[model samples]
Target chain A: MEAKLKYYLQIADNALILSHRLSEYCSKGPFLEEDLANTNVALDLIGLAESMYIEVARQENEGRTGDDIVYRRKETDFLNVILVEMPNDDFAHIMVRQFFTDVFHQQFFSELRNSKDEFLMGIAHKSIKEVLYHLKRSSEWMFRLGKGTVEAQEKAQVAINKYWKYTHEFFLENDTDSEMLKAGIGVDLSLIKKNWLAKVEEIFTMSNLTIPTNDFTIEGGKQGYHSENLGYILTEMQFLPSKYPDAIW
Target chain B: MNITALSKEELLVEFEAKINAEQKIEPLDWMPDEYRNHLIRQISQHAHSEIIGMQPEGNWITRAPSLRSKKILLAKIQDEAGHGLYLYSAAETLGVTREQYIQWLHEGKAKYSSVFNSPALNWADMGAIGWLVDGAAITNQVSLQKTSYGPYARAMVRICKEESFHQRQGYEIMWKMMEGTKDQQEMAQDALNRWWWPSLMMFGPHDSDSPRTGNAMRWKIKRETNDYLREKFINKTIPQAELIGLKIPDNNLVLLEDGTYKSGDINWDDFWKNVNGNGPCNEQRLAHHIKAHTEGAWVRESAFVSGFQK
Candidate 1:
């Protein structure tokens, strides 16, 4: 039971953090259409997190609300991988990070749809539709950036190099993941990784970009370890709610 | 179409007759130069306001208290962006390119609403801006739905419908805060106090003093005077504030037997100052947009190049 809850937290934490990152680009998109599209994805990711966290609150049965789970948790307890917390240094960096995650999620959610837990399966069923659209958008953006102009292609290359090292953490499983896999409650990250790489390679071929050869990887999200980024994200995200603990927004 | 072959005086007479008869004027209609320029200026400025207005509300999107709040604010800003697009498209019908309109905004030759020039200072400023700022803008826009120009009026109809929800969402925030702790109540009241005067400033100057109103009203481009709309906003909004237990922040305010709230004099000095490019956030708002525009140039260029290659 405890491993199942952590399984949900792992996914929720990633979506919630990434949603915040995308929301930062609300009015700052490269164009009006892109601005709307970026924020639309931000809204969808928050909805994804909302569903998962609501289930987390329900199963915990501690009289805790979804808001409490999101707002009251300390920095060290969040389980999102380091990649989603990466800064949106520019549009190139933003799209590369999104493409990496979307490719992974496209496989992860499709696998989760086969989970023994029906409610979790329902979430995956719903989320896979959104993930499909997300994958299409990010892949199109990757192709555009990789083939667009000389300078744009250079920026895209820099961004991919910066974020490629963190993608390995997506498949890093810990005790909770293993336990959930044994119970048939969560996804098999190894299978997700193979599919992620194939789709990525296919897109890169059309994008005229190269996959990074260096495979230096680090992993700590399962232990609630994070980079310096999550703290700043939590501080800004939790400001108003944290100020007045009794307040309801 | 045949109106173009008529003499200038005859065309003017026909245009006035159409406006007087409440008939729609199509894009091909032979309107005067002054009329065409007025619609271009008004529509583009409105579009610029929608674009720049995103800044004040957008700051709170990341900091929104919950998933629901975050989604609502995000969707609202996206609608503002959509509104900007619609207005720009409508203005383009008058033969101006969207690029030229954006250039005018960047060069400071175009002016948006003065209300956005002030900073959104607090969390409750979100509520205040939606309730007060959007509320006031809606009051003016509701009348604009019946404006004489076809495209501008139709655009107003769509924008006003979306705008109604924003004001209510804002009022909902204020009501929830008013029901919260003392600090929250203080925040809500503070937002109201700061935003109230600026919202009144949104309605523009009184009819007698407005130079633009002369031609704008005579042509039905402006359906109502500025003072009339300001009074309507004050009358409708004060009761909402009082209902939510917020003070109106106007010492000289009065309530008439006719159930209207007569506001004190607007701070026209500040209004004029902001109009003349000297507000607290006028430079910041425009610069934020210019920076985004500048940064986005490469993305646009790349899309154009790759688009042609395809």
Candidate 2:
């Protein structure tokens, strides 16, 4: 695979997997309004993934449709960060995962809007607005939960501690990043990491939460190394298309 | 003279006059205890139905055959949640808290629409639900827009608009399926067969047997009878099903000269069974609802503690 194609898939898969995770909260949200809000965020992420997947299909030029890329790929072929594919164990966990990703996406998409590739730039420009809203909502929840009762505060802390290691995967760079950056088709991850940490620290302080000092980071979802969760997600997501191959839904 | 000083008989006379004159009964206006209780029951039940209705369609969101379908399903389910919120707010105006209503639901003391007790077993079930279930709901809600309660009527007006979109998207799914391979067509037909009678039952019992119908109609809370709305749904939906070439699952269904289709008898025993919590998915639906509620207790408590509630 070409570096450019691999780069697009990496970003696209992150949105796709995370969107799938968020969509699971559709009917199961704690309240009606929260359900609607979560689904809206999920829809926005899916829209982003659709656009990126369209570009991926175009670049692949293998007669593969966007649906083919999303539904037909094996778990190992997905390039999303493992953070996105984790189960939504609780509302706090969901919000914490979202906050981490939303902060990264806010910076990443804003910078990607400056990419040399016009399509990537267009997607990034359009998506950054939605990501900003997501960031605000997640940050508000973070503060709400952190400053809430002892139970809520503890839950939020637990979620942050559990998910903290996954944040490292967001900044891990590979040859695809180097190639895309050299070609002006991607933004630098180091800058995104710096901005991400500062934002996390600032929000954590306001929420009365502490940032983890742990240095151990789990990686490899970008290289198709994933947790056990992704396989179950794909099995459910791809069931219909796989069962009735060649039939239009 | 203080409004509260009015005698019960005098207050009843004024309330009846206002209702008879087709005036909307606002939240702060004087209403009889029975009227208030009736509106609370009806509106809260509607709200709970919308919430419970999410699960069957939600079952297919992940397995939606395409991105477009997945997004549409997600949006539709989200709309159901929005409808739940609207109806819950409307119910809250009757002096019942949302927590109270939800508690009743979790306790199985409150009733939602029984149609959701049936499972959506296939991807095509999405189409059937959107077309048949929502089509039936719109028929009932269109009449509900004229209900005497002001807030409930306004909520119906907004809900009806979104429901029409849901109905169309559902029909679009069926249409696309019918145009696909032979197996796809079969799937659509099978789904319609399973959903048709249940959708008909959504209008509640027949006029003669419905206990709430008389009082509801006298109060103008229900402008049409169950039989009337069921007829209207049948008349509107049969053609849409025909256009998609899916069978109605009613062997005895016929288009009467009065332009309404007369179908075979509904399985009222099954209907009552489902309503009384004996249906295929009654346990599953309520269990899922209670689980979500119980698991979210701490979250709700936190929201309250943080002054997130008004």
lDDT of each: 0.90, 0.91
Candidate 1: tens digits of C-alpha lDDT, residues A52-168: 888899999999888888988998889889999999899999999999999988999999999999988999999999999999999998888888998888888899888889999
DockQ of each: 0.79, 0.68
- Give the DockQ (C-alpha) for candidate 2: 0.68
lDDT of 2 by residue, B1-310 (tens): 6545888899889999999999999999989998999999999999999999999998887788899999999999999999999999999999999999998988888999999999998878999999999999999999999999999999999999999999999999999999999989999999999999999999999999999888889999999999999988888888888887888888888888988789999989999999999999999999988888888778877877777422
**lDDT at residue B29 of model 2 (Cα atoms):** 90
* DockQ-derived CAPRI band for the predicted complex in model 1: medium
For model 2 chain B, the run of ten residues with the poorest summed lDDT: B301-310
**Which ranges of candidate 1 are over 4 A from the true structure?**
B1-4
What TM-score does structure 1 among the candidates reach? 0.97
